[model samples]
Target: MRPPCHAVLPVIACALGALFHATQAAAALKPAQLAIVINDADPDSVAMGEYYRKRRGIPATNVVHVSIPGKPRSIGVAQFRLLKQAIDSKLGPSIQAVLMVWTAPYAVQCNAITAAYTLGYDARQCAHTCAAGQPSAYFNSASKRPYTDHGLRPSMLLPTALPPIAGPPASLAPEQARQGAQALVERGVAAGARSLPASAYYLATSEVARNSRAGFFPPAGHLPAHRLTIRRMTADVLEGAHDVLVYQTGMAQVAKLETLAFVPGALADHLTSHGGDLLGSSQMSSLRWLAAGATASYGTVSEPCNHWQKFPNSAVLLRRYLGGDSAIEAYWKSVAWPAQGLFIGEPLAAPYAVASN
Candidate 1:
């Protein structure tokens, strides 16, 4: 038997409101809770670490340096285990998340670096890289400190994708790379002041399979009239949308990206396979959103189980962020199967975080 639509609305609203208030009371994770990992062998990684540390005011002791080489793109499980042990030993138990500053070695076998760190190096997590492995402990909880509440931590990658700059090094010039990385942190700080308006665009595509999660999008009229604007589109993509704070849709690849504008601290992502496979050629990379100026984004490194339930729910993400959760926290909470998804961008970008404080 199914409940009537009207009867379900209040229950849903109540649940969301309770989640919002509970999370509102919790503080966003601080820079002190993060342990920054830098690959000493890569100058670009080192520069990024330095820049992020200075910009976020991270403590010197919290920076952990490792000698992982910058090639091969993936490391052996045993090698990654050792690195994890080293990080755990150096940072102790106080750390709640890790910020890996290098672009290379993003995967440990089939597990993304962020996934491996947060959930540990389990071959099961790798066995089905496309499928959902496990639910994250930090999802939708009132706990600000992941280690304290869930006994599991969360992680994110900085400089997920580098800008195109011709250089002897060829990947990204050190200064240019640092600027790109620092932009994320700066935007997060700026979001604290509400310098930009709160808005969201939910593109409900005509593709039936892709739009399976469209039912989860919030009603446009229900959003706070003054602080936020919600737009629901029945097209493939929205055009000329400016200062977009949150944009979500499902498609193989997003089109007309150049015409869309993203404000600093904006959260944008499209549900698609292989978007999280940062270096793969199969589909559009999740890094495109970062390149387009969004502060944070999410995508699956592999197939992601192909069920709408396994993917992020737009309503949960928007409500959590509107209620003061950090970008990483809100995004993490919205997904039922996060083990396969790689959350990339500024972990601490919290536009609504200011209101709570």
Candidate 2:
């Protein structure tokens, strides 16, 4: 028995625990199907693009070159529209996923640029930060080709600056960004095409408001087929885990991350209002997950009022990832309403691709 779904909107909250039992073999995303967008003006972006292209063997045709002013952290709708047009026109018809290379301009108006690009600009998100912004077609869907099947591209950010530089000279920022990006790309490329044995941590934090995602946590056990162990516990911060694959918890400021070790192609994130503010978020930035050795993470750019729909639903994400969907697919599919959230990481990381039935 399930609640009635709205005619125009899909039912988001449903019992789909059985979804984890089956893998979507058709949902495997390939490197050629992904398009990497680079800001030619930004040398760091260009350098990271080339490095990722070579490492992932992404075709030159799939590399998109655009010239956009990379200064503002959030650009107006007008400027974003123009920039999106330039990149969209060249994406052609086969690109299913997009990788944006740059740090600034992660948000357009109030919506995350990654969400705005895939779902189109949501004027409503800017109008009310706490209101339901926009419904996504790819949310929890079994669609393999988001662009071809759903007519919408799924995008993630491969920022030039992953673990952002703090108290560093302006001249050293680009070099440091290049090194960080190179490390991120290497981690992603190394996490895939095989079965992996890893642990998924779901912590019930003391912050009641931030723990909206607690209900969505999957049971704690070992699924030998996928080589995954799901663990549920009540703790504020995780410590001394050597094989961390999924670390999803709610906290304004996550502490003691250095105490744990994250596996390659790992997915980790904290639930908070400003985690998506990549540059100067008051809370811990999503970038910290990457710095802590996780391959991908998500965070909301604006105030979302702790709506579970605005954050990644762990059940859906775990199912999709175990089902052979890439990092971008699983992360993007988990969020019911993603207009306010930002997806950042290597889009192609799929450590469990070989385990799917």
| CA lDDT of every candidate | 0.71, 0.83
Q: Which residue pairs collide in model 1, if any?
A: 130-303, 130-304
- Write candidate 2's Cα lDDT for 296-353 as tens digits: 9999888899878888988888888888788999999989889989999999998767
User: What does each candidate score in C-alpha RMSD?
Assistant: 4.3, 3.1
For 1-357, candidate 1 gives per-residue lDDT tens digits of 121222212223224334323334245778778889888888877877887788778899999998887544678989989988887888768888888887667677766677778877757867665544565555555567778878877888876345531222246665665676667667766766665555689887766567766777776743442267777788887777886898899888788777877776789988787777766667777777776678888777666645554566777788777767788787777765566667788887777774333
Off by over 4 Å in 1: 1-26, 129-132, 164-178, 355-357
By summed lDDT, the worst window of 10 consecutive residues in model 1 runs over 1-10
Instruction: Give the residue spans of candidate 2 off by over 4 A.
Output: 1-13, 24-27, 164-174, 193-196, 355-357
lDDT of 1 at 230: 77
